[model samples]
Each structure stands twice: as structure tokens, then as C-alpha cells.
Target chain A: EDQVTQSPEALRLQEGESSSLNCSYTVSGLRGLFWYRQDPGKGPEFLFTLYSAGEEKEKERLKATLTKKESFLHITAPKPEDSATYLCAVSNNAGNMLTFGGGTRLMVKP
Target chain B: DAGITQSPRHKVTETGTPVTLRCHQTENHRYMYWYRQDPGHGLRLIHYSYGVKDTDKGEVSDGYSVSRSKTEDFLLTLESATSSQTSVYFCAIREGQGYGPLHFGNGTRLTVT
Candidate 1:
């Protein structure tokens, strides 16, 4: 079965702290991996999509890197405004439906 | 933010009552999806539509029905609402086929009494 798992269910970081969230997958044929940011009561906002191992994408203070079996979202110099639940999902070559990870709840205290 | 919107952002209904949630998109994307969000579960697919009159069930599709009669609208109907079904519903759309990124709506918070 295809699956995605994220660790550090909840993290509390002070402003300017740098850390990375993990997303490990066991999907056989991965088409893409996605990252999203979701606020408390809103839907997820698209972040980055990594298609292959060694692939990397960035936006502002966030960077995502992918490997054969896992992906990492590294947040640099995070701010309080950057606090949100980060979600990871994978699209398999067999289908368009995305399987999502439970997500990491991040809190960047200023 | 994408041009996706969900109706009845907040709803409270009695158990065993029929309920429907609407998802509207202005981007005219061909792929539309419905999902429910819970505390431990990130997001679970309820149903999805590829085009007008073309829809299919998803992983957690039981007890839910969906219809897409137009390119911009998708509706999820609960035959009879249950307390377990009281969750935040979200609508998403993809701009292209295959592994394209999905844009999501703000979501609908449904409560059953």
C-alpha cells in the first residue's frame, strides 16, 4: 500500500530558528511530492512540488528537498507569521489522487 | 489564493438530516475534488470529478454522493448527516492533468447535533 508519514506532530520554535520537517513515503512509483501550509481554520495553501530525488524548490524562507524515499521541508529564520500546519502529499504514477501525510503543526514564537 | 469557494462556511444541523455542500471554482479546471479534514487525519478524499457528468468515489467515499453537472460546480450530498460526519469539508481543483498542484477552497465547517 502507498503511504506517507510525517514526524514531529507538533513543534514549538522561537523566531529565527531553523529546522526541517520530514515526510517519508513508501509509494512505488512517485509522480510528485507536494508541500502545503494550512492555517488553523483554513484550507491548505500550495507550497512546492518535487518530482524526483535531488529535486529542490524554494519560496521565501522555505525550501523543500526530495529523495527516493523521503522529502524534507526546511524552514529558515521562521517568523511567528510562518506558524501553520505543514502538509505533505504524494501523487503516484498510477493515479492522480494524492495521498497526504498527517502533517506537522509548527509554532514559531516571536 | 485560488478562485475556489465553499458554501455554508459554517453549518449546524440535526442528526439524520440531509445535507449538501457546494464547491465552486472560477478557474474552469477540469479536475475537482472533495475532501474532509479532521484533527488526526490530514485530509481524506470524499469524491472527485474529472468533467461534467463524470465523477467517481474516493477512498473515504461511503455515505456520500457527488454530482458534477457543470464545469465549475461540484456538490457533495450526505443522505443523512451523522455526528461522525461533522467535519470541515474542502474543495480543490487542479489546473492540468497528471501531477499538477491543487488549489483549495477555504473549507466548510459542518456540525451535527
Candidate 2:
């Protein structure tokens, strides 16, 4: 069975604080991994997609890195607006859809 | 987001009643999906459509049915609403294939009494 697990169910951070969320997975054949940001009362927004290990993508203060067994979402100098539930998902040979993690709730207090 | 819209942003219905949720997309994406978000469970897929009139069940498809009569419209129907069915449902779309990131709508909150 393919599964995704995210760590640090919830995190509180101060402005300019940096942290990294983890997403570890086990799949038959790894196709891709994705990251999303969902705010309260809204659906998730697409953030990044990592297809292979040692790959990394960044947008503004958010950066996503991937490996054979896990993925990381690093927040650098986060702001209040960056506070939201970050989701990690994986798509592998088992299915054509994404298998999502429980997600990490981040709170950046300004 | 991504030119996708879900109708009935909020709904409250009684048990055993039939309820339907609609999803509209203007991105012309070939792939559309319905998922429910709940505490501790994250997001669980209910169903998805690959194209017009082409739909399939997802991980959690029991008691749920979907239809895509048009390229831009997908409908999810709960044959008989139950208390366990109350949840925030999200609709998503993907423009390409393989590794295309899905774009989601604001979501619809459905409450079953």
C-alpha cells in the first residue's frame, strides 16, 4: 500500500522564523510528490511538484525538496500570510491519483 | 482557484435525503476530482472524471456517485445522506498529465443531520 505521513502536526513560529516540515512515504514506484497550502475556510492551493530525489523547488519564502524516501518543505523567514495548513501528497504506480498526508498546520505570528 | 467553482458553498440537509454537489470548471482540464477533508483524515478522494461521461471511484467512494456530462461540469450525489457524510468537500482540476499539479476550488461545506 502506498502511504504518506507528515510530521509536526502543528507548529507555532514567530515572524522571520524558519522551519521545515517532513513528508515520508512508501510506494511501489515513485512518480511524483506535491506540496500545497490551504488556508482556513478555503481549498488548497498548488505550491510545488518534485519528481525525483535530490530535486528542489522554491517560491518566495517556501522551498520544497524531495528524496527517495521523504520530502521536505522549508519555510524561511515566514510571515503571517504564510501561516496555513501545508499538505504533502504522492502519486505512484499504485494509482493515478494523489495520496495525501495528514498535513502540518503552521502558525506564523507577526 | 484554477477556474473551478463548487456550488452550494454551505448546505444543511436531513438524513436519508438525497443531496447533490456540483463542480464547474472553465480551465477545460481533462481531469477533475472530488475529495472530502476531515480532522485527522486529511483529504480522501471520493471520485474523479477523466473526461466527459468518464468517471471512476476513488479511495473512499462508498455511498457516493459522480457524473460528468460535460467537459466543464461534474456532479457528486449522495444517494442517502448520513451523519457520517457531513464534511467539507473540495473539487479539483488538472490541466495536463503525469505530474500536473491540481488546482482546487474554495470548497463546499455539507452538513447532514
Candidate 3:
């Protein structure tokens, strides 16, 4: 079974502070790793997809990087509106289903 | 944003009643998935469909059932609602196979009292 684990279940950061969220996984053969941001009472919003080790993607103030066994989502100078839960998921080469992590809730205060 | 839509944004029902959640997509996506989100569970897939009438169970599929009768509609039904089944259900769609990112609906909040 493919499994994913996220670190620091919850985080509180002040405005303009930067931080990173971690996602560790074990799979038979990783096909893709995904990052998503979900606000309260809302479904997850797609952020980026990292296909292999050394691959990275960026959008707005968020950057995602992948390694052989884990992925990291780096938030640069986060603002108050950046507060949300970040989720990580992996799809194995079998292409069956995505295994998701418990997620890391971020709270950015102004 | 994806064209996915989940009906009955918020529903409150008593235990033992049957509840059905509907997911509709405007764009013809080949993959449709049903996931439930809780406080600490994140998003767990309950079921998914590859095409019309082609469905597969996910990691957590014990209490839920899904059906895809058409290209754009997927239905998830609970035989008998239980308090444990209360969660925010999200419907997601993907245009292609592997590596394609999923687009999700806003989600439906179900409460089984």
C-alpha cells in the first residue's frame, strides 16, 4: 500500500514569515506527487505536480520541490491570506488511486 | 476552476436514513473520484470511476457505494447513514490518466445526526 505522512500537523506563522511543509511517502513506483491548498470549508485547490526527484514548481508565493522519498512545499514571505491547509498526495505507477497525507494546517497572522 | 459541481452543499440527516450525493461535471473527463475530508483524515478516496459504469473501490469504501450511469454524473450513496459518515465530500475530475492534476468541486458538507 502507498502511504504518505506530513509533518507538523499545525503551524502558526506571522505575516512575512517563510516556512516549508514536508510530505514523506512510500510507494511501489511513484508516478506523480501533487500539492494542494484547501481553505476552511472548501475543497482542495490544485497547486503543483512534481514528477521526479530534483523537479520543482512555483506559483505565486508557493514553491514545491520533490525528492526521491519526500516532497516539500515552500512558502516565501507568506501573508495573512496564505493561511490554509496544505495537502500532499502521491500516485503510483499502477495509476490506480492517490494516497493522501493528513495535511499541515497553516495559520498566518498579521 | 474545474466544471465539477456537487449538489446539496450542506445537508443534515438523521441516522439510519439513506443519503445520496450527486457529482456533475460539464467537461467530459474520463476520471471521477469521490473523497471525504475530516479533521485529521485529510482527503481519503472512497471510490472512483474510469468511465461510465466502470467503478473501483478506494482505501475507504466500506460504508459508501458509487455509480456512474452517464459520462458526466457520478453518484455516491450511503445504504444507511451513520454519524461516522458525516464529513465533507469532494468530487474531483481529471482529463487524462497519470500525471494529470485533479480539479475539485467545492464539496458537500453532510451531517448525520
Measured against the true two-chain complex, the DockQ scores of the candidates, in the order shown, are: 0.78, 0.76, 0.78
RMSD of 2: 1.0
Residue A17, candidate 1: alpha-carbon lDDT = 94
Clashes of each: 0, 0, 0
Fraction of the real A/B interface contacts present in each candidate? 0.67, 0.72, 0.77
* Runs off by more than 4 Å, candidate 3: none
List TM-score per model, in order: 0.98, 0.97, 0.97
Tell me, what's the RMSD of every candidate? 0.9, 1.0, 1.0
What is residue A56's positional error in candidate 1, in angstroms?
0.6
Give lDDT: candidate 1, residue A35: 97
Q: What is the DockQ of candidate 2?
A: 0.76
Residue A57 lDDT (model 3):
97
Stretches off by above 4 angstroms in model 1 are none
Residue-level lDDT of model 2, residues B1-113, one tens digit each, is 48998999999999999999999998788999999999989999999999999998898999999999999999999999999999999999976865677889999999999
Q: Write the per-residue lDDT of candidate 3 for residues A28-101, one digit (tens) a residue.
A: 89999999999987889989989999999999999999999999999999999999999999998877677899
